[model samples]
Target chain A: MSDTMTNTQATGGDGAEAPRGVENLPMVKALNAGLRQAMLDDPRVLMMGEDIGRLGGVFRVTEGLQPEFGTDRVLDTPLAESGIIGTAIGLAMHGFRPVCEIQFDGFIYPGFDQITSQLAKLTNRHEGQLSMPLVIRVPYGGHIGAVEHHQESPEAYFAHTPGLRAVSPSTPNDAYWMIQEAIASNDPVMFFEPKSRYWPKGEVDFSSSAVPLHASRVVRTGTDVTLVGHGAMVTVLLQAAELAAAEGTSVEVVDLRSLSPVDYGPVVESVRKTGRAVVAQEASGFASIGSEIAATITERAFYSLEAPVLRVSGFDTPFPPAKLEGLFLPDADRILEAVDRSLAY
Target chain B: MQFLSTDGVFSVSEQSEQYAPYLERLTEADHRRFYRDMSVVRAFDVESANLQRQGQLALWVPSFGQEAAQVGSAHAARPQDHLFPSYREHAVGFVRGIDLLNVLRLLRGVTHGGWDPKDPTNGNFHLYTLVIGSQTLHATGYALGQKLDGRTNTGNHETDEATMVYFGDGATSQGDVSEALVFASSYQTPQVFFLQNNHWAISVPVTTQSRTPLHRRGDGFGVPNVQVDGNDVLASFAVTAKHLDDARSGQGPQLIEALTYRIGAHTTSDDPTKYRTQEELDSWVAKDPIARFEAYLRSQNAPQSFFDDVDAEAKDFASDIRCRTLALETPDMSLMFDHVYSEPHPLLEEQKAWLAQYENSMNGGESA
Candidate 1:
C-alpha cells in the first residue's frame, strides 16, 4: 500500500461504529454514516429527493435513513428535479438545512435553472440578509456501464458560477468528513459525489477531519513529478503513480477535495518542488477543471517547470454509450502516458 | 359577474349571495378607504410613467387600470401573510408598507432589487420577481415550509399564516407555474394563487395566452378556483377575503383569477398603438376601476373634502418622486463583491482586495 493509504488506515475511525472507530467501509456507507451524524448533530438538517425515502435512493446511498429520521425529514420528493431543488431553496429560506439529491448526473439538467439562476443568485440578490444553508448531492462521473443520462461530469458548470461552492471527495474517509462539513456550510454547495468510488472500501476516521473542506492534500510524495486530480480521477492518478514508481520514476499525487476556490496553495507548492506536473479528469478537456489547473500552475510556477503542464482528460464529445464509456473515461494507462510525456520533456 | 356594477350599485342576486357576507365584513369606512387607495395608486402610476418618459427612470411598468384588483386583494391579505408579487404590483407593494421610493430605485437603475424584504419597514411583501411565473414556485415552496413549520391548518384562521403569489395571464404558460400548482395541490399547502388576467401581456392578448379562462387552469391541478370582475373593487376584496380565509383554515390552495384590464403600455419601452386598437383601449378605459370606485364612494355620502384630500396627497407623492429621485446617489462600486456569498469566500475576498489595490494605484496612492 502507498504510505498515504497506510496512514489513513491507521488513524481511521470506525464507520457506522464510533469512538471505537471503524475497520473498513465503502464510500457510500461512509456518506450514509456522515449524513446520520449530521442529522444527530442538528435538527435543522433534513433531506429531500426522489426515491430517497422507501427506496433509499437508486444507488442505496441513502438506504435506511428514512426509517431512522422519519418521512418528514427524509422526504421522497416528486420526480421533478426542478421542484425538488426549487422547494429545497424555499425550505432553506425558512431556516432548514436541506441536503437534496439529484438521482443521476445526467438527470440534473431539469433543475439546472433553479440551481444556476435562483439558488445561486438568491443569497446575492438578498444582499446577505438570507443564507441558503443547503447542499445539492449529485452522484457524478462514469465507471459503471450504465446507459445514457446515467453518468456525467458537470461540476465545471457550477464551478464557473459564483455564489456556489463545488466539491468532490475521492475517498471514503474524505466523503464521511466532507459531507458533514458541507451540510454545516451556511452557503449553498454542490457536492459532486463520485459514483464510481461508491463501492470502494476504505478506512474512515470519525474522530476528526483530516483536512479543511477546501484544502488539497498530497496523498503520495515524489521528487520527480506532481499529479493533481479530484473525484475518481484522483484514484487513477494514484494508480499511475504506483506504476510509474515500479519503472523507477518518482511521481507525487495530490487529492483535490474542493473543486472550486481550488486552494492552489498545495498544488503550487508541489509543482514548485517537482518542476513538472500532470492533471487528470473524466470530464471533457474544453474549459474544464484540468485546463484550469494546468493554466494556473504555468502562471504561478513558470520558472520551476521543466515541462508544460499536461492534462489527461476525456475528449470533447457526448458522454457516449455505456459500452463505450471505457474508451471515453481516463484510466491509469492514459494518465501514465501523460506522466511519461511530462517526464520526457 | 360583478356584485358592484359600473353604475356604482351593489346588486347581490342568489348567485352572488355567498359573497355578500364577506362584504358585510367591510364597513362604509372601508369602502371610502379603497376608493382613496385606488386614486392614490393611479396618480402615482401616472407620475412614474412620466418620470420614465423624462429620462428620470430607466423604465416604468404602469399599474394603470389594474388598481381595484391590486388594492382589494392586497387588503385581503392578513398582516402575517407573505405575498410574492410580479413586477407591476405597485399598489400592492404600497399597501404592504414597502417604501415606494425603493421601487423607484429599482426602475431608476440604482439596484437590481431596491428593498430588503426582511426589514420590518418593508412588511411581509417579498421582492418583485421579473421572471414570469417564477415567484409562484417560490411562494409554493415557502407555503411548503409554512406547512412543515406547523403554521398552517392549526384550526385558527386569524392566527394562521398563508402565502399569496401574483402572476399574469401570459405567465400561466410557464412550466414553473404548472409545477407550482402540482406541488401546491400535492402538499395541500395553505396558499392562494392570485392571477391578474389583465387583458394583455405586453402585446399578447389574454386570448393568445390561454384558450380557457385562466382560473379554470387551476382546476386541472385540483385547486378550488373562482373568477371575479376585477374592475369591481368590492368583489375583488370579498372574493380574496374568503379565499385567503379558506387557505389559512387548511382548505389547501385556492386560485383567484381577477379579470381586469391593463389600460397603459406594458412598459415605457412599449407602444400599445402598434398592436392594440384605440377602440379597445377606450372601451377598457371607460370601465376604469378608480372612476367606478369614486362613483361608489360618492353614492355612500363621502364628502367632497375626501376627494380633495386624496388629490392633494397624490400631487405631493408625485412631486416627492420628481424632487427626491434625482438626488438619490449612485451605489458604491464595491457593493458588487459584498453579497455574492454569505460566508467568507477566498476567491471573492482576493478579488475584492485586488480591486481596491488597483483603484488605489490608479489614484496615485500608496498600496499596502
Candidate 2:
C-alpha cells in the first residue's frame, strides 16, 4: 500500500508509466502511503487527530502509522477539534509540519475559527515572519450514507478564504502524490478527501504523478462537450461522460483537483475544442465551486460557448436523510440531463 | 494572597510565605527596575490615551491600573519562554524586551502586527490576539510542542522552555479558553495561563463572567491554581516566579488569577463615567500600583532625587513615543498583497499586478 516514486519517467502529464511498478490501492491506503513517505522524509512531519493513533481514525486512514512512526509523531489527540487545529498552528510555528485529520466534514465547524481566522491569517498576520506549514485532512462528500453530519462537501468554505489553499484528490494516484505535495507546501492547505471513494481500488502509479498538485487534468478526451468536477463528483462526471459517449455525445471529463486558485487551463482548452461545458459538484450550486467554475468558464470562453455553462449540483439545502441522499446528490442521470441542456444550444 | 501591602510594605502571609523564597531571587536592582517600569508604562499609557483623544490613533486600550500584574508576570518568565498577549498587555511588552512603540503601530492602524516576535528587538512576545482567549490555545499548543521536543522538565531553567498566555476575565467564558485549559492539563504541557481579572470586561462585571472564583475554574480542569492581589507587584512577581519554575520542572500547567482594577475607560472610545460611581473609582485609585511602590521606596529611605529622576525619565519616554508615532508613515499599498502566503500564489499575484497597473493608469491620466 505504501510505495515511493522510484524515478521512472521524471516528467509526463498522465499515468502512462505502466511499464513501471504500480499498486492497486484505495484512496485511504494511497493517502497513508503519502503521509508515511512525507514523515519519513522530514522529521518535523507529524499527524494529530481524534482516534488517529490507536484507532487509526474512524476511517482507518492512519492505521499502523503510530506503531511505525511512534506515538509522539502520530498523536491520538483529545476529542476536541478546535484544540487539535489550534495546537497544530502552534506546532507549525514551532517549526513542525503538522497534518491534522478532521474526523468528518461536519465536525470541522468546531475548529472553523482556528482554521479560518487564526491558521489562515497567522502567516499574513505575522507579515511573512512566520510560515504555517499545516494540512487539515477532511474526509468529505456523499454516497457513504452513514448518518447526518458524516457526509458533506465543505471545501467551498475553505476555498473562499484568501490565505488558505484548498484541494481534493479524485483518484488513488492523485491522493498519493497530492498529499505529499501538499505536505511539502509551506502554506496551510485544506485537503478534502472524498470519503465515498475511500474504498474503491484504483491504479496508483507510484513512479510519477500526472500533473502538479494544483493543476486540473482532462481524464478523458472528447469533442462535443466538457464535463468538469472534483472529488466524488468527478466519478459521477466520468460516469455521465461514458453514458453520453454511448449516445454519441463525445463528452470530455475534466478532474478539478484544486479548488482554490483553480487551474482553468485544461478545462478552458477542452471547452474551446468542445464549444460547451457542464460543471458538477456534490456541494450546493449557489455560491459553490460549481458556480465559480461555470462563471469563470463563461468569462474566459464566452465566444467559444455553444450554450450557457450548465451546472449539475446538490440541491441548495442541508444534506437530507441518507435515504434522500440519492436524490440530493448529482448522479449520472442528473449530469446527463445537464449535458443535454448544454448540448441543446 | 497579598505579599506587598497597599502602603508599600513587603510581608508574607501563611499562604504566600512559600513564594517568599522566589522574591529572594530578585536583587535590589530588580526591585528598583520593577518600580521604574511600572511608572514608565503608566506614563506611556496616559500619553497613548491622550494621542487617541487627539485623533492621532484610531483607538487605545489603556493599561492604567493593571501595570503591576502585567509587569510582574512578564518578568517572572525566562527568555526561552514564549508569551502570547491579549490586546492590552502594554506593561508586559514593556517589561519584556519589546519596544513600546510597536504596540502603537497596531492601534494607529499602520500594521496588523507591530513587530516580528522572532526579531531580537521585539523579544519572544507574539502578536496581540484581539479575538480573546484564542492565544491560550496557541500557547498551549506551543507548550505541547516543547514537551514533545523534550525541551521541558530538563531541570535546567536556562534550557527548558515554557509558555505564558495573557487574557482578561471575560475571555474565560469563551469556548477556546476552556478547550485550551483542557488540552494543557491533558498533555501536561509546561505553560501558565495568566488571567488578569481586572474586575470589568468593558461594562460587564467579572460577576457576569463567572459564578465561582476564577482561579478555581482551573481546578475543574485539574490544573494547579492560585489567586493573588494583582496590584501588589511584589506578590505578582513572587507567585508567578514560583509557578513558572514549577511548570518548567514538568509540573504541568498552572493558572494564576490576578485580581486588579481598571481605573480608566475600557478603551479611549468608552466612557467609564457612564457605568460606575466615583467612589468605586476613587477607592481603587488609592491602591494605585505606582503610588504603592513609591511608598515602599520611601519606606526603604530612597532619596527624593531618585523619585524626581524617575518622573523625568517617564516624561521623556512618553514624549519619545509621541515623536516616533508621529513619524510612522502609512504602509505601502503593495504590502496589502504581500505575506498572504509564504509561496507565490497565482491568484494573489495576478490580483496584485492588476491593481498596480490600474493604479498606474490612473496616476498617468492625472499627470496628463
Candidate 3:
C-alpha cells in the first residue's frame, strides 16, 4: 500500500499526495473499495454475476476485481439473472456471503420471480431457521441516456416482498459504509446502486462511524419544507434545496438509505419541524415509493401539516429517449414546482 | 410404455427396492384419496382456464396432463417436508392443503401471493414461483438449513424434513438449475429436484430444450438422476419416494425427471394449436396420467363407491372454486403498502395518505 493511502482515515493527514481520503472517491470506486474491504475482512465473502469477473461489469463497477481476487472468489457467471440470484441463494446456504450483480435494472425482471417468491420468503418460510445472507446489487434508475427497458425503476417491486430488505445509498460515504452493512446483514438485501450517480465523486470516510443500512440519514437540515429522496434522486433533491434556499425558502433534505424497513424517525422528525414535504424519485408517480411516502406523512404528521404532502416524480409514462430524459426525470425544477404547490396550499 | 420407451412395460430398477416399503404402505384408500385430490385440482385448473377465457382471470397456467406427476411426487412428501413449486403445480398445491380458491385468486390478479407459504395451513409448501428454475436453488438452500438444524432423517419419519422443488424440462436449460445441482451436491443438502418434462416449454419442444436427456444433466453435477414414466402415478410415486428418502437420509441431492406432456396451452394467454398438431395431442391423451391411475385403481378391486365419491367431491370442489373465484374482490390498493416492510415506514405511510386524499378527491369526498 502507498504511504498516502496507508491509513483508513476519513481525511488526509498532512500528506500532499492524499487528497480527501476514501471519501473523495466516486460511487463506483467507493463500491470497489467497499467490496475489497469486505472480502479482506471475511473469508466467506464472494462476488458472482454476469460479466462481474473478466469484463468487470458493463458499468466497470467490478473492474479489475477478478484479477485482484482471483476467479474462485470473483466469478463470471452465465448470462442469466435468475441463475445469478438463484445460485447466490445456494452459495449463501453453503456458508458464503454472495454479493450478486444483476447486469442492469431491466434485466432483473427474469430474476424477479426468484427474488420475490424464493429468496424473500425462504427465511420466513422456515420460521427464521434459514437466513439467506445474500446481497443482490442492481444498477437501477433512468439518467444514463439508455433505451426503454434499461432505465426502468423497479425498487417498489422488491421492496413489496415480505422477507427481503431493500436499501440504496446516495453519497460516497453512505455507499462505502452501507455496502459493508448490507453484507453483514443476515437478511437478503436488494442493494440498488443508482446507475447515474456511479461516476459522481464524494467523500467516503472508511474508518468513520458506520451508520446502519436500515436507518435514514438527514442529509441537509431546514425548516420550511422536508425534501425526501434516495439513490440518484438525493443529489437532485440537494440541488433543489440549494435553489430553494437561494429563493428565501428553507428545505430539509432526507436521504432514505433503506427502502424496505424504511427509517421513519428522521423523515417524521423533519416533517414535524418543517410542516410540509415533497417526496421525489425517478420511478413513475403512480403507485411508487413517492406515493408511499406521501401517504405516511399525512397519517403520521396530519396535524403538523400545513399542506398535503406532494410528489415530484417521473410521469406515468415509459422512460423516454436520451433527449427527452431531461424532461422525463425529476429535476430541481419539478421538485421546486412541488414545493411551490405545497407552500401555496 | 409406449413412446420414448424400449419395452412394452416400464421397468423399475433394482435400486428401487429402497422405496418398496413406502410404496407398499400406500393402501387402496390412499390411492383413492390421491385420485380425488388430482380430480378436484384438475377441476379447479379447468375452471380457472375457463374463467380466464371469460375475462375474469388475467392468466391461468393449466395443470392438465401433469396432474399425476404433481400428485404422486407431492404425496411422497411428508407434512414436515417443505415444497417449492412452479406456477403450474395445482395438484401439488392441493396435496399440500392450499385452499383451491387461493390458487384462483392469483390467476384472477386479485393478489400477488394468494396464500402465505409460512401459514400452517399451507402445509410447509411455498406459494407458486413463476420464474422458471429459481425455486430449485431456494429448496436446496432451505434443505441445507434443515441439515444445519439437524432436522433431516431424525429416525422419526414424522419429524424429519426434506425439500422438494418443482420445475420443467425447459428450466433444465437454465443456469440456475445446473448451479443449484452443483451446490446441492457439494453441500449434500437434503433436496429433491423434481423436473416434470412435460414435452413443451411454451413453443419450444423437449427435443429442442435438451439432447442426451434432462435427467442425465443431473448426473454431471454428481446428483443421482432418474427418469420416470410421468403419466404413471405408481412410477412417479415410487421414484420420488426413493429419492426423497435418499435426501432425507443425508445421501445428498437427487434429480427426478417425470416424462409427460403439457396437453394444453402453457397458459391461458398461449395458443397450442398454432404450434402443435392434433396428432401430437391425441398421442399424449392416450397416456393420460389420471385415466391410467383410475384404471389401476379399478384393477385393484377399488369399490364403485370410491369413483362415485371422488366424482361427487370433485364436482363440489369445482362449484366452490367457481363461486369463490367470481365472488373474489380486488384487494384494497393501499394494502400493497402494508407488507413492504415489517417495520413502519414513513415513506409508505406518506404515500398512503396522498393516495387516500387522491382517491377521496377522485370520488368527490368519499374514501376508497
Q: By lDDT, who's the top model here? A: 2
Ten-residue region with minimum lDDT total, candidate 1 chain B: B1-10
Model 3: CAPRI class: incorrect
Binned by DockQ into CAPRI classes (incorrect, acceptable, medium, high), candidate 2 is: medium
Q: Native contacts retained by model 2, as a fraction?
A: 0.70
**Inter-residue clash pairs, candidate 1:** A13-A22, A13-A205, A14-A21, A14-A22
Model 1 agreement with the true structure over A1-345: per-residue lDDT tens digits: 011211222222244332536559999999998888778777889999989999999988889989988887998887888888888887787789999999999999988888888888888877778788889999999998988888899999999988899999999999888888888888889999999999989998765544677888999999999999999989898899899999998999998889887999989999999999999999999999889999999999999999999998898999999889989999999998888899889
User: Model 1 over residues B1-368: C-alpha lDDT tens digits?
Assistant: 57888877778977677887888878888887788788878888899898888898999999999999999999999888899898999999998898788888889988767788888877688888787887788888888889888997788877799999999999998888888888889888899999999988899888997889889988899999999999999999889989999998888999999999999889999999999999988988888888888887888789999999989988888888778887988888667898888778888888899999889888998764
Q: Tell me the tens digit of each residue's lDDT in model 3 across B141-248.
A: 668667766789677666778999999999888777877887678768888999999989999999998888889987788889888888877667878887898889
How many clashes does the backbone of model 1 have? 4
TM-score of chain B of 1: 0.97
**Error in Å for residue A143 of model 1:** 0.8
Q: Candidate 3 chain A: minimum summed lDDT over ten consecutive residues — where?
A: A1-10
Compared with the true structure, the alpha-carbon lDDT of candidate 1 equals 0.87
The per-residue C-alpha lDDT of model 1 at residue B338 equals 85
Q: Per-residue lDDT tens digits of candidate 2, residues A1-345?
A: 112334343332353434445989999999997787788767899999999998898998999899888989999888899999999988887888999999999999999999898999998889999999999999999999878999889999999998999999999989988898888889999999999999999999876644577889999999999999999888988888888878988989999999987999999999999999999999988999998999999999999998999998899999989999999999999999988888888
